[model samples]
Target: MKKTMLLCALLMSAFAAHAQESRQDVSISATGTFSPTIHGATGTYTNTDTSLGALVSYRYLLTPRSGLEANYSFTQNTPRYVVPGTSDNNVHLRQQEFSGAYVYTMTFKRYNPFVEGGVGAMFFSPIKDFQTTQLDVKRTTVLGGLFGAGVAYELSPSFDIRAEYRGFLGKTPNLGHEAFTTNRYRVLSMPTLGIAYHF
Candidate 1:
């Protein structure tokens, strides 16, 4: 038992020494959300509005090149349903995302390029106003996968400018109504640019 404990302690000490110094960063980004049009298998189609959004992220580094990031993004989206001969109507949705990602970074001089992938929960709340048809529609939340690729250009020891393309993969929300059903999984693309601050 003594030998086993010693070995375990030694291994843990080695691992701790091998880990890089911890670093943390916070970033705020101006983003654009663009969703694809889904053509259903049953002669129905759904299209989402392209809108402006914001992304806030916090990252903690466990190693020099590997870390984890938590992100929150918000936007307003309008999805319209077209059923070939009826009146076209749209649902104004307030969209929010809560996600976490494993980030792997590569550094080249003052430039750091990174890739991230993870899971997210998408919350969509529809505004039942004059633009929205009164149905049995309510709020809904969908789980999805999220990914990003980006590059950061260091300006100083404490600041960097970041540009990234992020995407979310999920099923189209129906807002609890059959008219909004597309039965399709699609991606929402976001192009982001922002600045990060480090301490």
Candidate 2:
């Protein structure tokens, strides 16, 4: 239809204008994930494995100093559980995070330091294998909060390398089973380094 074509043309025009102004950027990063041991009050505890992962981020600047960002991360690790004298249990899980945040940036020379805070959900899916000891466990999702502080060094008009530390606060994943339940909360630390391309 003519109307549909007109709308599509307008949308493309807007996007082209936005890209010309360098108002958006996309980043891909490698991360090192570290989670501390969590001890529950009811004699339950969890120890999570340190692992390597990846993060993808998109940002749209509302102003020169403020913007909105969306981030997705993927990591797979194992968590070992100890529940009051039961045999040790460990589950191999693929964990994912989906979050959106408000990003504030300050510029000094070519270094842009930024901070962000947001809310999201964490999903843990157990992989059935010899490494996973619990058969009854299933997938679990929990709401959580994430915060980060980092600096991006501008290499050119369209490229930069960034380093950051981000933390996620959430309840320990129990996978819908008592033996693995900690009924406690913990923080997962992610340190990242990567490059970004502006558009």
Candidate 3:
């Protein structure tokens, strides 16, 4: 974690110096986010879980109104569900994803409204102790897509506050479903808040 913070600080400093030259259309940023997933399932089970993650991104301004973004994020923690007459089940799902996106940004007097969509791959790891001791599954990689929008407020010339909502759609080896119970792959949406420095 210290290494991550140091790297981010160094990158921000580099960007700060670069911004003075010409306000480089291409900006690099690091974002730390808290994400929770709410699965659309009911009765005897619930897939409400949360995670903390970080992303490193490079955003290139394609034009005044549109741009392209590439991002890589690390997220962890699986969903948990409780069952009657059995031990509590816990799954540890960790994901590392890389995505390319198209962004439409609108600048207001003090707020910037942006919408983004992208496609990527998510890697999921499973912990079977939460389900049955006899059950063991290998990690899987799945393709996914995401879409979201957010607003950013400029706090200063170098810093900005941002809030965003994003969703991921993917499939895997029934991380939440079992033989007697089949689980469907669906989209997971998350909202995040953070700060970014533009160089």
Candidate 4:
């Protein structure tokens, strides 16, 4: 009981700190990610597919240290596949995600470190030129989770350079008619470098 109460008190304190930082401010940032794609069958295997993408986020600061963030990302990868009788082919997959998250910032003398997490939905589209038809899969409102640490070097009060490493987790249904299962869970690791501006 005591341990649980202490945990609750700590959470309350964090919330209070966030509330205190909510004030009128705006910030915009861009990020790039490189993530690998994996395919699952009787077992799981790496597809040897790597993706590169960029995202832009807008934050409405409720306080100096906390805010609400709206982010969108676009990425693409090509997976090479081989079957016993069929010719080897490459399948192209593109993804887009939109999320809303809570962001907390901590500034040091010349660097600022922050943690961010969020949840949202993702859309996946697979374009296989060798196939007669394209595969488009839409996962409805899938849960998204992100955790990252970033360093920002302030060039000015409103503009700065930031670098971060973040990981993304989500799932989408596989649209291949031949597959017995309909769901595929996606996990990615992304490192981003970009500039940010505060208003």
Candidate 5:
């Protein structure tokens, strides 16, 4: 019994020491985002917009090649009308998303390539008119999903630069409280650049 207990204690101590030596457990990143046109319909109007945005993410590595990540991003653009006489009149359309993903990474020397998939919620808000006091004409929340791929180049043991392309899928947003004449879907393509710090 005494020998067995000693053996287990020794094994536990070795594991703790190894964990300390391999401490790349947490990472944080800041990103700049660009999104191309998103198309959808609400009532009789079609919505299309391009946007520039920002994102921040936190990741916890479960292993060398696998991690869980949470991210938040915000984007704003002006929706172009498909109708002949309709005009945006300079109003801005805005979206904010919060998501969680599972990431898989492949590591080689100083470069790591990764793929991720996730689901979350998005908040949409639109401005009625740029010249008026109505900042948010309507606000709504909807389900959203994402898939992405990226490459990270390590600058040091603790920092890296990353670039990624992501696609966001969701139902078309209705800018007002009226009933929808059509239920449409939209996919927004986003490219991002960021720097990550690992600890």
Candidate 6:
């Protein structure tokens, strides 16, 4: 009876040690984002410029294959009217988003792939220059959703390099609130490259 009890205790200790070794609790990452032009409200404003942005994220592991992540991103672009005779007038459109997601990861040696989905809120503001005669632009807050997938390569026990593609869905922002209010939905695609540290 004593021998059986001793073996049970040793097995339990080994299992605990193995569980600890396989667990990764937390991770932080910094990323660069690229967003393409988006058209709004009967092509009233067609943003033709590609933009650069930045994102920072924190993730907490709930299991070996799943976790919760929160992230924030900032993006800015210049948009112009689609009319051919329109003068060269450009306005700065800035966006900031705060989000949380559920992340699922699959691992194979040094390679890890993940998929995430979440909901969030975004703030959109338009900045006009002194010479601009456009209507006053107001900062608007709207609800948004995101879906993304990524792959990560483990460089060390606590470091990784990652690449991800995320798509954001939200209402088309009406900065000027002109005559037309189409209330349409718009999508923004952002691809990011980053490095992460795990602890």
Residues 60-151 of candidate 4 have per-residue lDDT tens digits of 86766787888788887654444335454445666677888888988787687888888776665665554413343222245668767788
List clashing residue pairs in candidate 6. none
For residues 38-107, what per-residue lDDT tens digits would candidate 6 score against the true structure?
4544645445356778888888888888988888888777655443355544557677889999999999
Ranking by TM-score: 2, 1, 6, 5, 4, 3
60-152: candidate 3 lDDT, tens digit per residue: 776767878787777776555454556555666666777888989998977989999989877766655554342444566768787889887
Question: In model 6, where do residues sit more than 4 Å from their true spots?
Answer: 1-45, 83-89, 130-135
Ranking by lDDT: 2, 1, 6, 5, 3, 4
Q: What is the model-wide C-alpha lDDT for candidate 5?
A: 0.69
Pick the lDDT winner: 2
Best by TM-score: 2
Assess the local accuracy of residue 123 in candidate 3 as a C-alpha lDDT between 0 and 100: 73
TM-scores for all candidates? 0.86, 0.89, 0.67, 0.69, 0.73, 0.76
Q: Can you tell me which runs of candidate 5 are displaced by over 4 Å?
A: 1-47, 83-90, 128-136, 177-181
Candidate 2 accuracy as TM-score: 0.89
Model 3 clashing-pair count: 1
Error of 5 at 29 (Å): 6.5
- Give the per-residue lDDT of model 1 (tens digit) for 1-199: 9999999999977755543233889999999999888988777798877899899999998888999999999998788887667777688879999999999999998999999999999998988877776456789999999998999998876789999999999998877878668789999999999999875
Tens-place lDDT digits, model 2, residues 1-199: 9999999999988876765599899999999899999888888888988999999999999998999999999999999988897888899999999999999999898899999999988999999999998888999998999999999999976889999999999999889997666788888999999999999
Clashing pairs in 4: 21-63, 22-62, 22-63, 23-62, 23-63
Alpha-carbon runs more than 4 Å astray in model 1 = 1-22
